[model samples]
Target: MRRTPHCRRAHQEHLGKGTPLSVIICDIDHFKQVNDRHGHLSGDRVIQEVAGLIARQLRAGDPAIRWGGEEFLVVVQASSGVAMGLAERLRSAVEHFHDPEVGQVTLSLGVAEILSGESIEQLLGRADGALYRAKRSGRNCTISAAGN
Candidate 1:
């Protein structure tokens, strides 16, 4: 893909009009342990399953990218509250998803609404930081960039 997404400019236009767009950063909790305890094959399956779950649940046209090994980033044309609600759904889905080989895998997510005049990088960083908070607070939960 390109350095930035084409929809980002669209997001900027909405931001220009004072509309909020939210980003959600998701990571598989204790992914390394999964790989160590099971195997790379199982770990890969876990990532693939989680990624598919997230991708399938988001808005049809929204961008759901594999941000890293076990991480996914989603950008949606919605408010922080809306995105947070979506994240919780994804977290719950992952929680209840039972992989025969990988067992149960949980997701921790961070959500951030684009601030006025904020760049895409800044928005994503804030979202990622919020995800880190969720990871720290334990796992299998969602956290918003605002306040906490």
Candidate 2:
């Protein structure tokens, strides 16, 4: 599904309007393995539960979107540090989240701050690179792409 207009507007307001924008790209760790081990139904339940948890934790100004299968994007009106904190919190939440059918879920997150004159593509690229770093270093952690 496409991202809602509200989600798009929030991104514009925060990233295009000169307001500080922090974008995070999160992916479930070993999600494919989960699907293989369990089943598609159980895997879907895990995705839904994690998405719900993220939506509940977000502020009114923040927006979270399911970017694609097993991946989510979070936009927050805050600085880089705040974004890192939020990502960490999300990781913690997923780690501790209990699912009777799927058990615990974990995620790796990549955070980036919108730079001056930067396009959405650039921001997303940075975040995606950071996500790769996080996954390579170890799963279930947050990585920042700023100043690198």
Candidate 3:
């Protein structure tokens, strides 16, 4: 999907001003197993439902995108603490979400705040690292980037 010019400009503005930005990457736990047990249709439904829940919880300036299958990225114009709070809320929302077909679902999340002069890849890598940590520690939890 094409990102709107406004969104692009906003990103550029952040880059220009060297503003700190926070990002959260979230993924469902055992998503493939859910698909295998409940069928692809049910899996898709769960994904959509979780996406909606995350979207609803976003702040006015925040944006949430479906990064990939069973994965989502949320951008928040706030500090790392705010980003972590948002991630925790999203995790809780998904955990408590009700679906007749899929029942309960859990999520693993990674959060990071962009540092001055940091590249997008670097920020993403930090968040990805945190996400892997969350998964390794045990699914259904939130992990912030190391040293954040």
Candidate 4:
């Protein structure tokens, strides 16, 4: 699937006025295992259910996109601290989410705020890197970009 231009547009929309722009990269933890243990249909249901949970958690008008097969990207107008807080809340929401077929599902999230003059791709890269760290440290957790 093609990636959306939400971040770039948000960057352009907020650049000159000093708006705080943040991004969160969220991935379902051990999703492949879920597919293997359950089934593809079950996996799809898990995705849908998790997406609903995430959508309900976000503030109205926040953009949450399916960045990959089992990953989501959320764009927010908030500081790094606020983004981290949002990430934690999203994590907790996913942790507690239960599906009749899938039981419980968890998420690993990474958050990064835009740096001065940084491209949207760079900000997303940082968030993705933080997500990798969260996955490595252990799933079902949130990580902020290092030294942000």
Candidate 5:
């Protein structure tokens, strides 16, 4: 919560090691509409609920950060395919998440495996692009980084 840069540093140790690292960027679909309809407090509750769902699904050592607002960033030390599976699982969980006040929520996710010799910015940019594609593709779905 201090800053996004601090969160990103947690994974720096494994970079340049040729490890199978991946990133997933998840965004709440139609989040503005939720805020407008349910009020900011409800929006906060929704963010908390979604964050909890994302946290529960992560394995030990993986990092899930509230990137900002209704968006989350997850770093997984796995292949792109594995990351895709994880993203899909998270999306499904959000789709089924039931809240007495907010009802069901959904997530659109973009996932990418870090390539050797790639910087964090490159990795995140790819993931973000994939996330954008997911949002464009109608949300509540996962998209893997193309050609990576």
Candidate 6:
């Protein structure tokens, strides 16, 4: 939640300097079932591992926040292409994770770049809508905002 404001401020500042700002909303694929079948401890382990993987992949100064249960928000100061690439890397890392407890974990990501006159809420909403699309498309994939 706090990260949202920081992301907005960063986006606002970078927008003035002609730098693009992108946000990624990542959700664990079928996370509720993981918890139900493997227990909450296993779910916690998966969450920790996922968070670590995301943090490791981020560039210096980029923010990766645990947005909610099985969901994360990553804010990057880069073009939409760069941000999408970063998300793909994270998704691949999660896919190939060799977890002894939860086995293979996967992520669905939504990437959205800040438009010239977009608000933070609007930006997040777009990314979230993209996330819904990714989930509906069978998960473990990445989808950028419309026309992006």
Lowest-sum lDDT 10-residue window in model 4? 1-10
**Per-structure clash totals for the candidates:** 0, 0, 0, 0, 0, 0
Q: Report the Cα lDDT for candidate 2.
A: 0.85
Which of candidates 1 and 4 reaches a greater lDDT? 4
Candidate 4 local lDDT, 41-98, one digit each (tens)? 9999899998999999898767799888999999998899999998898999988878
For 23-53, candidate 1 gives per-residue lDDT tens digits of 8889999999999999998998888899888
Better of 1 and 2 by TM-score: 1
In terms of TM-score, how similar is model 4 to the real structure? 0.95
What TM-score should be assigned to candidate 2? 0.90
lDDT of 6 by residue, 75-124 (tens): 88888899999999999999999789778989999999988788777888
Error of 1 at 44 (Å): 0.9
Q: lDDT of candidate 4? A: 0.88
On the 0 to 100 scale, the lDDT of residue 115 in model 2 is 78
TM-score against truth, every candidate: 0.90, 0.90, 0.90, 0.95, 0.90, 0.94
Reference-based lDDT, residue 85, model 6: 96
Give the Cα lDDT of each candidate.
0.83, 0.85, 0.85, 0.88, 0.84, 0.89
Model 5 TM-score is: 0.90
Per residue, candidate 3 scores C-alpha lDDT tens digits across 1-148 of 3343433554676788755578889999999999999999999988899989998898767878788899998877678998898899999998998789878999999999877766667777889999999999899999999858
- Estimate, for each residue in 15-127, the C-alpha lDDT of model 2 and write its tens digit: 55767877889999999988999999999989999999888878866878889899999987788899999999998988999899778889999999877777667778889
lDDT of 6 at 72: 95
Clash-forming residue pairs, model 2: none
Best-to-worst ranking by lDDT: 6, 4, 2, 3, 5, 1
